[model samples]
Every structure is written in C-alpha cells, then in structure tokens.
Target: MLPAIVLSVTIARPWREVYEAFWRPEAFPRWASGLSDMALRPDGDSWVGEGPDGAIRVFFTGHNDLGVMDHRVIPDGGAPVHVPLRIIANGEGAEVQLTLFRQPDMDDEMFARDRRWVRKDLATLKALAERG
Candidate 1:
C-alpha cells in the first residue's frame, strides 16, 4: 500500500447535486483535466477515458445514498490506482474530498505533479457544481 494524500474543497451546492455532477461519466472531461474523453463500455460496468498516458479504464465503486464516489483507474499496461472520493453535507452546501495514493514507484516530482492536477480538477468541479 502507498501513502494517501487527502484534498478537499467546499462547494456551495447540495450533496446530491454535487454527487450527481460526478456520477455522469460524460461530464468527467469537463472537470477532470486528466481525462480528455470518456465513453461508457458496452458492458456498462466500466468506462474508458483518454488520459495523459493513454487509454485508461475506470470502475466506480460507491453508492448514491452514502455519497461515496470511490473509483479505480487502470492505465494501459499499468497498475490500477484507487481513488477515494466523498461528498459530505455541510450546512446547506457540500464538501468534496478526494484521497490520492502515491504509487510505490512514484518520485517526489511526479507525486507533486499529481497533487497539483487533482487540485485543479477539484477546483473545476467546484466551479461547475456551484454554477447551478
């Protein structure tokens, strides 16, 4: 297992609406900067996206009621990266948290880059969620 880095942002929106924004695979590219495109597989259990590295497969493992948005990303010919995301109610808005694990082989530079990327993506998500 690798060390996990937790990042969070508070969005001025209900938990349900915030969660719904992330539930749709088609909306990934809009907020997830790393994903250039996303398309659902025929099986419907997973979705494929074009990542910085190449084609990447994603499998979401969470529930709507619990506001858990955890998912696993498998890059082509690479190990799977587990991402734990959650939406928590805060007063009338919601707080979004994402846990990113640093791969065993990742160096400081790469890990820092990943952290920045996640922060940017979270900002985008916040902007979108708050727009409504």
Candidate 2:
C-alpha cells in the first residue's frame, strides 16, 4: 500500500462558497495559475482538460467523484507531480487532503519534489478560499 500524507487547514469560510468555486471549471484559471489556461470538454462521461502548459499541450482528466475530485493534471515530465485533491469542509474551515500514490520505480527525489509542489498549491488554494 502507498502511504498517503494527509494535510489539513481550517478557515472561517462557509463550505458552500468553497464548493461552488471548486465545481465551476471556468473559475480555475483565476487562482491556480499553474495552467496558463484550461477548459472542460466532454469525454465519454467525464470532463477532461486540454490546455497550454507553456510550450506543450497538457492533457488532463477531471474527477467529480468524492468531494469534487479537487485535483489538477500535469503532463508526464512536465510538472514535478500533479495530484488531484479532495477538499472537504471540517467544521468552519475546509479540509484539503492529498493522497500520494507511489508509482513503481519512481525516484524518491521526484516524489519529494512533487509533494512540495502539492503543498504549495494547497496553500494557494487555502489563501484563495480565505480571500474569496
């Protein structure tokens, strides 16, 4: 089993506010600037992202399951690591949990670096929720 490091934060914001912002794909570009741009298109029964990641085209899948599937998609070898997170409300503030899975033979340093990115991104999300 892959070990998952769970991180959480509490804010004085209502769950509804955060939930709406997260579900609407149109609002993603404003806060998460990692992607230059993104759009939601139908794929079978899912919404996938086809956007510009600087020079390369980034193809990503969106998960609407279990707490909005609050996550991002980055191309292989493009971004250090892309983790889809589950953002839920814990009392007053929202709780964002990132579950990291160990891909076979993946380098430790790479996972570490990806973990760092995920942390920063989560922090950014928290700040946005507080500000918005």
Best by TM-score: 1
Q: In candidate 1, what are the lDDT values of residues 87-115, reduced to their tens digit? A: 89999999999998999889999999999
- Candidate 1 lDDT score at position 120: 94
Q: List the residue pairs that clash in candidate 2.
A: 11-93, 70-85, 71-84
Off by over 4 Å in 2: 1-3, 29-66, 70-84
User: Which 10-residue window in model 1 sums to the lowest lDDT?
Assistant: 35-44
Note the Cα lDDT for every prediction shown. 0.83, 0.58
Model 2 earns a TM-score of 0.62
Following a full C-alpha superposition, what root-mean-square deviation does model 1 have from the true structure?
1.7
Worst 10 residues of 2 by lDDT: 52-61
